[model samples]
Target: MDARFLGIPELAEAPSVAVVIDVMRAYTVAAWAFAQGAEKIVLAESLDDALALKARHPDWVALKDGPPAPGFDAVNSPGLLRSVDLGGRTVVQKTTAGTVGALAVKEASLVLCAGFVVAEATARILRSRGCDSVTFVVTGEDGRADEDLACAQYIARRTTETTTDATGFLRRAGASRAATELTEGVRRGAHPDDVALCLELDRFRFAMVATLEDELMVLRPHDVPSPTGTAAA
Candidate 1:
């Protein structure tokens, strides 16, 4: 199997399997939301569409770009989602990177959203499926964020059975410009815990696979089997 680590700009040429990574917050938040019992997440390209969807389905939570709207349940923060009740609830997510990357690579044979949390499971899925080529789409700020790049590298290392300094990778990501921005936001009463959460590696065992359901991108947890033939849910 071959794996290519590219930025979001390379999504035009779809690969056999594309793994969209956004470690700063987007994919991390989605993984936490799913783990917390979110029924489904609908990826919206624009905040207007997200709002419109929220208007149509008032029960669903609308996650916008900036701060959480007054009537909305939560923002795009994994730390915030940790405290909210997402049981059986649907979320409409609109972000600058992760969601956009997932939607853009719809042409891929398989699209999966990943973060540090599910890196190993994602690698397992790729190996299990026997994919010839895998593309890791690092969806960062214009595709240059170090945190996302580090995550892509980590996943690639896991898939290819290579060794990387995991501790060094996390340390570098914590000091990245994106992480610094989020840390600054934390001082202003934003979710301070998200910075630490996003940097934690392999926190979850299930891969979040993106699939189209009724024209909406829905992310669901895919349990990967361990080497011993047991399912890792």
Candidate 2:
């Protein structure tokens, strides 16, 4: 199957199997948390919703939310996740784009979380599962384009779909001046440590699944890691 890029509205109409990318922090951090041993991650679209989930499952999971700069939980920093002992624990998080993007594509048959941090891993899983078609969902920020598209482009390159013309999107968004910024630069504005984490190609071996249980969207990481521990091809 070919790969295509779709916005939130288009995403709502696409087929079931799809890959969601929110690289700036949401999916990137989620991948980090899972790598650190987090059993699952509850994704909330709003800060209040995430906090409320914690209120209901205080003993069931941990909460992290707020602006991209990090809040009570220290922003969406993948670096920070690695330091914590998530072992068997779950994290309930809300992000500006990632969480909302994942929730937007809820109808997808296979809604896997993705970003530059885990692009290679995500693709390998999809290929192993015999997936040929993909629609990369990029969560727009406040109606404006965000770094999510960049992440999507990064992963889309590994799929059967033609390579994404990242420059085209950047030019269209008028963020061309920020071209030199790259992934690390974009991430630094939010969480420098996390930017570094997102750049680690194929650091993990497992893929993350966005699942829903009791009306809450959660991420469940696989037990086995990828053979190469690398990102998308």
Candidate 3:
């Protein structure tokens, strides 16, 4: 098997099995929502589309990354989602990088949204597929967001049965500019726990898989079995 690490710019030409990683917050929020028992999540291309979807389905929970919008339930903050009872409800998500990266990959046969919160499960799912090639789309722009790239490295190493330096990766991730900025946001009264929650590794045990349905990028959890071929406890 071959694994190649790329960024958002290379997403369109990604190989058959691809994992779109957004460790700063997006996919981490999705993981928490699923852990809270959300039925499914729709990855909206834009905030406008997310609002429209919320309008169409009043029962669906609309989530975004910006200031409050009309009819939106909440922002994409995993720390905030812990209090909500999301059981059996649909979630419509909009974010600048994560959702865009998930939708931009047109050639991948399989697409999965990932973060450090679900990194181990992401690797488990990829390994079980037995695919020839896998592409890790670190959804950060240019050389920014080193945390996402570190996550890709960890998942890649895990999926290929190679040794990974989790501690070193975590150190690199914590010192990144993205981490610093988000931490600054916390001091300004944003979701204070978001940065901490997002950095927690392997917090969830399921992989969030995305599939295009009626032009919507729908995300649902795919449970990854243990190396012993049974459900992870």
Total clashing residue pairs per candidate?
A: 0, 11, 0
What are the per-residue Cα lDDT tens digits for candidate 1 across 23-57?
Answer: 87888899888888887889987888888889999
What's each prediction's TM-score?
0.93, 0.75, 0.93
Give the root-mean-square deviation of each candidate in angstroms: 1.9, 5.1, 1.9
lDDT of 2 by residue, 125-227 (tens): 6766777678778665532345566666656665544344444533332342222243335434344455456555557666778877877787887533445
| lDDT against the true structure, each candidate | 0.82, 0.64, 0.82
Model 1, residue 3: C-alpha shift (Å): 2.2
Name the lDDT value of residue 13 in candidate 2.
Answer: 78
Sliding window of 10 residues with minimal summed lDDT for model 3: 185-194
lDDT of 3 by residue, 68-139 (tens): 666789887777887899999999998878988888774578998999888888888877888778888888
Q: Could you tell me which residue pairs clash in candidate 3?
A: none
